[model samples]
Target: MHHFFSMMFSLLAIIGHVSGQPAKGGSERNIDRPYRSELTVSNGMYWGSWGYKSMCPIGRYAAGFSLKVESPVGRDDDTALNGIRLHCIDRSTGSSDSYDYTTIESDVGSWGVWTDIKWCYSGYLTAFQLKVESSQGNGDDTAANNIKFTCTGGYYLQGDGTNWGKWGNWSPTCMGKGICGIKTRIEAPQGKGDDTTLNDVRMFCCD
Candidate 1:
């Protein structure tokens, strides 16, 4: 009887996978992903590979982040923004200087240098907006160039990104508490073709 039940359970698991249902660790898109909200922007461009989802440790949430940006080099291939990294903290701790906090980021492009981290000073990150340039047609194209985040403390923080694109609409506010995970789309270096490093992004919120 035990063997029969075990076989049935295994068969059920296989059936779930075959039927394209969400598995134990993740959905059809990634593994070890965190709880996500539907809060996202509609202005992201399409030109890169989607990266893996990266989540903060449980009980922590994003309060700040930094940008990876390449300074403009005249007459050179310019990829404005390359990546974003989230700095997480435990709001319950109250002591913000603790060494136990964690940092998280998804895939990033190969250019640019990481900048100093920015923080909310009082609360966690709740929503975000992006600045993206449209297709240049024949000139240098830098897709996503800058970003801004809204904090739970009712303030906004901006990244130290390059200036090239127009700001888009903000994403929906977090449904739970604040953002806790991230995923990005980045184009690999095209060697000689126009390269628009960082493209689109998605943030996951947690309670």
Candidate 2:
């Protein structure tokens, strides 16, 4: 009778184990899903009188960034934009950090193309700073006026105090259609104070 009870207990344990096992297709259905997120654009500042604005609003949840350089129609031939960098947010820790990218300022009349996108090692991009030169408004004057970012989902909480570019005085309102883009107004070739020739323009997206 003792042996019989022991065998019955062992049989019951086997049945429980078999019943607890996953179904034939259960493992496939239980696989984890891939991560996904959306982009959020934030309007940066319009610093200085001739501050340039980005082509697209920098996404708050920026995965990467690019810079824009211009060679004004009637200004210096030597000066131009070189490169750009970014400040990223470590989403896991909610901390801010910086990433840099520089270019060779060798070409002449070469309106520098957008630099390759630089991704955050850990998180998304939040803010940006520029490398500019004001040759007292001299000839061949070049400076950076605009920047853009590639963004992902939930990068910035609304009013979470993420940094945007500088915001200068608002431009005159559009006559009929709403303002959807920006353009810089430079003090080109000015030979006195700062010759901020690469005046900046920005886009104004309406919510």
For candidate 2, write residues 3-120 as lDDT tens digits. Answer: 3343355346435433563122122111122112212223322223533332212222323443433334343343344223222222443434342211111111113344444555
Candidate 1 Cα outliers beyond 4 Å, as residue runs: 1-33
Tell me the alpha-carbon RMSD of every candidate: 13.2, 25.6
lDDT for each candidate structure: 0.78, 0.31
Candidate 1 lDDT, 99-163, residue by residue in tens: 44566777777666778989887779999999999899989888999999999977999999999
Top lDDT prediction, candidate number = 1
The TM-score values for the models, in the order shown, are 0.82, 0.30
Q: lDDT for model 1, please.
A: 0.78
Clashing pairs in 1: none
The reply for model 2, stretches above 4 Å from the true place, is: 1-60, 69-76, 82-110, 145-207
Q: Residue 206: error of model 2 in Å?
A: 14
CA displacement after TM-score superposition, residue 192 of candidate 2 (Å):
20
